[model samples]
Target chain A: MIATRPLYTPLDRIGWLNTTIRCVLALLGSYANAVLLGSVIAITLSMPAKDATMSAIMLGFVVQLLAVIWVFYARTLIGAFVGLALPATAAAVVLHLLGASL
Target chain B: MKFDKPRSLRKSMTWVHTWTGLPLGWLLFAIFVTGTLSFYRLEITQWMQPETQQASIYDQGQGLSTATKLLEQYASDAEFWSIGFPTARNPLYQLRWRAPEDKSGPENAKGKAKSNAKGNANGHAQGNGKDKPQRGSNNGHNATSADTAAKKTNAEQSQPAESHLAKGADGDKIKPQQGHRGMMQLSLDPATGQVITPRETAGGEFLYRFHFQLYGMHWSIGRTIVAIATFFMFTAIITGVIIHRNIFKDFFSFRPRKGQRSWLDAHAATSVIALPFHLILTFSGLLFLAGQLLPMVAGAAYNGDPRGFLRDYRGFGAEQAAPNPNAAKLVDISAIALDALKRSPAGIDSINIKRPGKADAEISVTTPEGSLFSGKQSLASLQYNGVTGDFIPATSKEHSAAETIWKFMLSAHMGLFTTPVIRALLFLSGVLGSVMIASGLVMWLVARQREREKLGYLPRGHRLVEQLNVAAIAGLLSALGAYFWFNRMLPADMVDRSHWEINGFFAVWGLCLLHAIVRPHLKAWREQLSLATALLITIPLLDPLTGGNFIWQNWLQGQFAIIGFDLTAFALGLGLLYATLQVKHKLAKAEVTKAVPPASR
Candidate 1:
């Protein structure tokens, strides 16, 4: 009987490093996503300014959790980065334009 | 690139869970334990300050009048005055005031210094006679400071003290002072208008603050560290769920006394049993910290003013109109409370007077929300003319759907609105979280130790982890026991008594760490666990020694908080004792196995 070689070594140092990087990306990417989403909601809502801001902030956490999970589960690093960056950029642009109009 | 493979997601997540969870495991454990205790923060505070056992059952109107009279006597010229009404949990009317700017310095400093000396002398007289010399000198210092204060007051009485604010000659704009704000807080007995001077103790507030702010560090730094740890915890929980395939199988599985398998089973059971709570708590904790962690969004939107963002977000209307300089006489506060109660049957939670002394003083009476879980600060409030007591229409606006959901989430996380049973369930969930983290740390060491034994030699890193596991887990429990013991043992009037309690906690924890490093891992665990058990069990005994009513007495008097605390301590002590026995039995079994040869078996 032959013992099969494991795909990843136990306590692999490089594996640890990669996971750390992903963890950091998860935080940053999710934060960006939250901000973008929150801003859009704030702009679209017709409620009082404070309510709009609060609603955006609350919704932001849900978006953040989704973004973080996506970072870990994405097929490729570049794919994950691209996925997060596109929405973040779009939100930023929309928020800036709305602010200018105000 | 390697992690990008489809099959490697589980493996990669397993790796993530291990590293993220292990590194901050100890800190997360401490935070969870302290935070869980904070759920019963008010109860623990009531128990710790035993002197405040007497509850006042005064009528609301009488209580309000009493509070007002005390304020008038002590802080008539205060720039800002606020009163917090008594509740079932705390039967004292809390009054706080910010003195007019000019009176903040020198005089207040002298008063504080004199109070400190007096406190020290009192503590020395009450404490066991171990330091007579220090007590005598403190007494001397107290005498001198008292004399100086008397002389200074006499001199001031001869001539009017300098007024910080210029008297507004009818229709002058009263400019508020900047930079110099002197604040004072006093708790008054609701039954009698006199101040109730309870012995200074940190009580459960220490645990509440320590969970977030951690002691001896800048608040921001502490908050950031806690937030980062919480993020890792969130990550670990997610990764843990992904990596484990047999969630239901693990949930119902428990094979005790099976060594490593038993530990694994315990960990899985704890994590799975309260998985929802863990998720809610971790997510809500992050949301609670959203303002601090992700301030940029709000800062950018509100031009760097977080308060403005919060105000707009919560829909608090315009600030109270400025004080009417020409208006004479302040309206009676009791009238507002009574009038508001008549209009709204929900009862008043608090009353905020914007400009208490001036004619334009607007009194806002906040009505308590019916639900305990409602996140809003106040469900409804009515504003009234400060001088005439005529009701000004309610200014609190309706919250949007988003805001309402946000508030509900925050309140649900806090469990402040919940009944005692629900709070206990939350606390039990927290206890499970602490256990899950502890078992995970031990499981790591057990697995690693097995691997090292197969490889013939254990590395330094493995040994370090072993030591850390013992120290951080059992050692921390012992330190917590010590904190409670110190609360009872320390002199009531001791100077910096709260600081001493905190220091004692750390000192015991540090000693435990040293013990772990010096002793064998198993022996260290057994010893610390035993110490924790002894300390915890003896805690109830100290209550009697410290002049506190016995558990039975408190139980009879319906002071369940103290009784509950004592009983909980005893139960935890028994749990630790059981753990200690298990450790001893395992150690002895290991010795017997070593003595016998495998060939003979």
Candidate 2:
């Protein structure tokens, strides 16, 4: 086979397991972070309530996309997890302080 | 850069692209095909309902008078009436009126209302066929709910209004709906003013809804599934770009007949060509389904009842006096239309009355108009008092920057603001997007050839993937072709004819899947695609043979929508034929290679 090995996958059991974890992180963790980011923007953006919510919701997808890429690109699983968690925690705290319900 | 890490950005992205794209590729392909065709949903409907095609050669005065007569005779006691006059795409003289609440039977009302709602579903707001205008100022979340709230206040459906009180910003949402609820309709021949009951086919609406909501199952669940798949597609598109090492160089490169390389090149070409459209459509699709996908985003801010957020997002409350049910003659629609024409000069498209037989009724004469970047089409409309025939000045709200951005993205996604030429380009872009997805899916199978060959024969999973490639790609096309044929061939008055046509689509698609599983791979591709080709090529003939005028005759009548649909189908069929010939040519080469052994090589 004269094909290039640039896109090769050396998926041993541990690597497969690692990929699986990242996949979950990309889907679930990213979404958790995204809604938080969106909520923060929706509440805090100085525009009208409707515009703020809309702009935030639309921008949420971009945040989610980046989070997915970050999950795969992170050096370790812990790094990926913490990257999402820290911001989510911060946003939750802010919303809580602002009397946002849930 | 030389860190001893397993992570390579390009490698991971390439992996992500494949995994995310492959499983959802077939679903995305189906969505693209249907959504692309939905650019001409109204046109497809016009073509499908040929009984009204040759009847578009009448004057606007006649069209309005017929609607007025119909409404006066049959719908005197109705709540509201909407008249969609003869237009280029909407060739039928449409008269829709909501029956007074007590008169409407639940069972009869749901079917009749839903079937007619299918017309407004696509044409009125011009987005995803759902009642919500993507970004219309008269966005129905503000108007219809307010209108429905006035009616349903006695019922329990008025709970969304509690959020309005909490927000206190809805002081401008008094817009009344054109029509909703148990609305009955009449589609008359505009040329002769005769009743033209077009056959009950799902028409383009089934495809439009199925693209997002899918079929058979509960709509919310279907919408969620589509949303998740859409997110996966969005990820794949971005990663696909990241993984393309020489994206620019590869974009222009094509090596035909080189198997794997050719597929890759085709993938690259299609992806690069329609990159902007792919991104816009995928992202906007997520936003379209966002309410289901991320309710928490809106919920978290709006006290876990996002109705407040939705109300504001769709814009706010303006109070208007409700119709008192006191009978009063409606002012002449022709006079209102003439006044509206004098005001706009571009001419009126529809006359939607809030209360047809009441003194306080409002008449809105909407023109076929829009600025492409501003918002959805049909923005230029004049409202009038129903009895005194006074023109009601529009309380035009200034669009916020945020709303403008939202509107721009939405209008671009809907392409409702496009010229005919632009619409064709958007459709072409969608076709390219579909080809991109299919080629990438095929490349996954092709690139795995060495691994399979090294195992001496195909593994079960690889075999399944091979069968799916045939079924999902060519087989889906075959189903769509069969759907069109069923629309022509089915007995029009047969009960549940539309459902039968859709079922015929799935049934043919299921047969193609069975054939794929049973036959050799190449043979399955050849047979299904050839069937699709044959079916599509004869669509032009079907138009004339099955109760439609000749293409030239339609041209004479200025009924260009059907002519356009027929020509487009023929062109698509030609393209498919070319693809079929290529597959057959490949099969021929395989046959020759097998005839001689490795000794010859």
Which candidate gets the maximum lDDT versus the true structure? 2
Can you write out model 1's per-residue Cα lDDT over B267-371, one digit (the tens) per residue? 889999999999988877876666666565444456544445644543333453344566447788887787878987866655656556766666666554434
* lDDT score at residue B205, model 2, on the 0-100 scale: 67
How many pairs collide in each candidate, listed in order?
Answer: 3, 8
DockQ of each: 0.24, 0.39
| Shift of residue A70 alpha carbon in model 1, Å | 4.0
**Model 2 B-chain TM:** 0.85
Candidate 2 lDDT tens digits, B1-601 = 2112565888878878888998888888899899898888778766776655656565553556766765676567666667766666676667766556633333221211111122221111111111212212121111121112222222222232333222111232211113234445556666555555556666776777678878887666887899999999999999988988787898778999887899899999999988999998888788767776777676555776555565444332233244376878878878888788899776666677866777777777666676555554235447788888998786666777877767677777788657789888999999999899889888987888777666666677777877898888888888988898898898765666667878899999899999999888888889988999999998889889997978888888787888899999999899999999998987788788763222111
Per-model TM-score on C-alpha atoms: 0.78, 0.85
Best by TM-score: 2
Q: Which ten residues in a row have the lowest lDDT in candidate 2 chain A?
A: A1-10
Best candidate (score: DockQ): 2
